[model samples]
Target: MTDDLQSWIGRTRRVADEMATPLVRRMAALTDRSDVALDRGAVVPNHWLTMLFDDAQPQSQLGPDGHPSKGDFLPPVPLPRRMLGGRRLTYHAPVHVGDALERETAIAAITPKVGRSGAMIFVMLRHTITGPNGLLAVEEQDVAYLEAKRNAPAPPEKPAETPTAEWRDAWRPDPVVLFRFSALAFNGHRIHYDADYARDGEGYPALVVNGSVSTLFLFEALLRRNPGRQIASYEARTMQPVFCDRPAFLCADAPGADGARNLWVEKDDGAMAIRIKTRLT
Candidate 1:
């Protein structure tokens, strides 16, 4: 069983190089920064390039969940659902708009594990992105495959809640925000915006929020907390799904001894949705 999936461990693909200007402009517009001027060689923001080289599968090839049926590049795991588990990103240099860029992605590791919930498969991919000036960034992105309709156990009880946070902000993302994000990122996963499919088809209590959106919220709050800090490296791990109906709060601990700051998203029910760690220059 593992052998079949293991064949994809070293599989690699190189996406055609593309100009970054148009994508950067479109992303700015989606995020309500249309007034920001982007020149040919201007630096693009971190994590802005989410869906640059996706496979263009025709409509007939898509699954009921609104994702392209597996097995083209991703291994055909038997699990019926998949979600981003986390990512570690190293920014070697600023990525500039209008630069010719190429990305090479390889399956780095595939492991099967069992947690309190049930069986799971984790697929880790190493993505190296390059520009005309050479290496720009490297990221290890983890995606998890799970059995459809599996009931997630209630999160473990926590200690007495802290009365206050070093920094905190909260907001409930409505369906419109989710829809606009999906459009900007070119993500077709129905769990994000399709309530009926997310409920009856995916076993979610509400529309599932995009994992990247959680990270984005935390990043924005981090900047607000420490104005003028430049991110050197960033890492995040999604522990559970954050639904659109629930309010998300970004909370951060004071900076650690090594200058790394810890941040996490608190879901409406008090469970942590994701853990984030970042270092600054």
Candidate 2:
């Protein structure tokens, strides 16, 4: 392992936390942008659970990419660009609005590999969040870092036609939506907010959408379609980049006999950007 890689492995941080009632209501409101009425002790939805914990790094301490200067909890990968590659979440119990929570974060692994794009580093982070009752969720998230891009490539061609799904909804995500979500999640990533930096610095076409936000949207759609259903497990893979320049649609197939569900998000151009598989209890 490289000196930097050896330095980051096996590091961990545990944060004692609580879920404030006001923030719960605010997240529910920001979620649909409608009049959402929530009380203090109400059971918080799984999707909104992520809004409880904040990274809490001071602004001055952030890096040029707008994230907290790495090497603290996360590894200081030398690559200039970083993004979420995918996530797998296991939800064990429902969290209430005003519950005391504890979150433990650790660097599970740092994998170095060479791909078609270039030299890459895949950092796997394991987050275990527990509530007063018991363990609430265990999530494994993949964070990828890559070398700078010299030439921006054209976007993928639109699929011939979008596949039909039993349950689906369309969303037109704008800058405001992305900004509000970033604020709520305490994500300071410049690629999601800075158009010039995303284009010139990162070689993206426009401000990129947050991958977690996309996952939440799919989760919200799933819950909306099947009320009162709790997700036992969820695995999501980001197939393509979803940009702010176009609309995106969320589609889900009917559940199988085993109660397993399949879902995906398709860009306006009809390309599938994310695929989600879920098991409900």
List the candidates' TM-scores in order. 0.90, 0.91
Each candidate's number of clashing pairs is 0, 0
Query: CA shift at 64, candidate 1, in angstroms?
Result: 2.2
> lDDT per residue, candidate 1, 1-281, as tens digits?
45789989999988865646767776676555544458877666655656466655688988777888988888888888889999998878776667777889999999998754567899999999988888878999998988767566545545334334578787687898888778766688999999999989988889998988777667766765555554678898888788886777888878879988778888777777788888876
Candidate 1 segments whose C-alpha is farther than 4 A from its true place = 17-19, 30-36, 151-164, 225-229
Question: Model 1: clashing residue pairs?
Answer: none
Those runs of model 2 whose alpha carbons end farther than 4 Å from true positions after fitting are 1-3, 33-37, 152-164
How well is each residue in 1-281 modelled by candidate 2, as lDDT tens digits?
Answer: 34558668778888877777667766776677243336667776776766656788888889888988877778878887888888899988887767889988889989988766778899998999998888999999888888888574544544534445887688877898788888877888888888999887888888898887787788777876667766788888776778985778888888888888788888876678888888876
Model 2, residue 1: displacement in angstroms?
7.1
TM-score of decoy 2: 0.91
